[model samples]
Target: MTKPLKASGFLGLATMMVVGLYQFTLLAGGNAVPGWMIGGHAHLGVISILAIVMGFAVPVIGVTGRLRTAVTGMFIAGQWGIPGVVWIGEGAELPFLMPTAFLWGICLIVSMLIMLYATLTQDSSGIGGEATGVTPADD
Candidate 1:
């Protein structure tokens, strides 16, 4: 994988971690978190899993156009959707959580855009290179 794609994948995983932690905190604190928050967390979790799966599946298939685009789109949508649901829909009042959520959203958005570019421009040739059955590069 190219540097940007690797970075994007890491950022995507980070966003997933943030979403999961946020949900777990909410649930564990017994604050009656909104159903939308739970749903949003679930959505982000699914996106994260998809990213991981595609990261492996793409190079395995040796075809890397449509699936990449779809994953990028889903990542962008989930990143924005989570914040929209939390801040706008639920109106969460925790000031400290806001910054983390905002940063996570921004990272996810930028990373998704970069990944989308890599996907469209054929720059991430080895994105799924370690999915087994493929020769590993010496470098």
Candidate 2:
């Protein structure tokens, strides 16, 4: 995969791992012995999963053009908005997992932006010159 796609995938995986582990920790009773233990970890997990799937789809499938643009935009919006909503609804007292969630959100947004730029401007090599053989000229 291209650098942007790789970055996006890594960010997505990181988000999923962090949020999933944090939620599992909470579900396994880790929030009880903490001072900044909000239950937003579960929401983070959901967001992370979405990010992971979207990131994977952006690079894996032949979804260039406006479809790719739309997906990347949605991914960015979700990554940032979900955490913002969680933070707002859960108050400012973030737990141990909050930082990871925030980082993941930023990474997702940045990665999606990169992917969007590449998709919009780069040639039809389909990320890293993978050769989809369906260039704009062919269409």
What's each prediction's TM-score?
0.44, 0.41
For model 1, the local distance difference test gives 0.57
The best candidate by lDDT is 1
Tens digits of per-residue lDDT for model 1 on 1-139? 3223334456656776886787778789986667666665665665555556545544544434674555455555555555555655456654455455555566556655655565676645555455667787999
Cα lDDT of model 2 by residue, 73-127, tens digit: 6565555555555565345654444455555567557656756665677556555
Q: List the residue pairs that clash in candidate 2.
A: none
Residue runs of model 2 more than 4 Å from their true location after superposition: 1-39, 93-139
In model 2, the worst 10-residue window by lDDT is 33-42
Predicted structure 2: lDDT: 0.56
Candidate 1: clashing pairs of residues: none
Per-residue lDDT value at 72 in model 2: 65
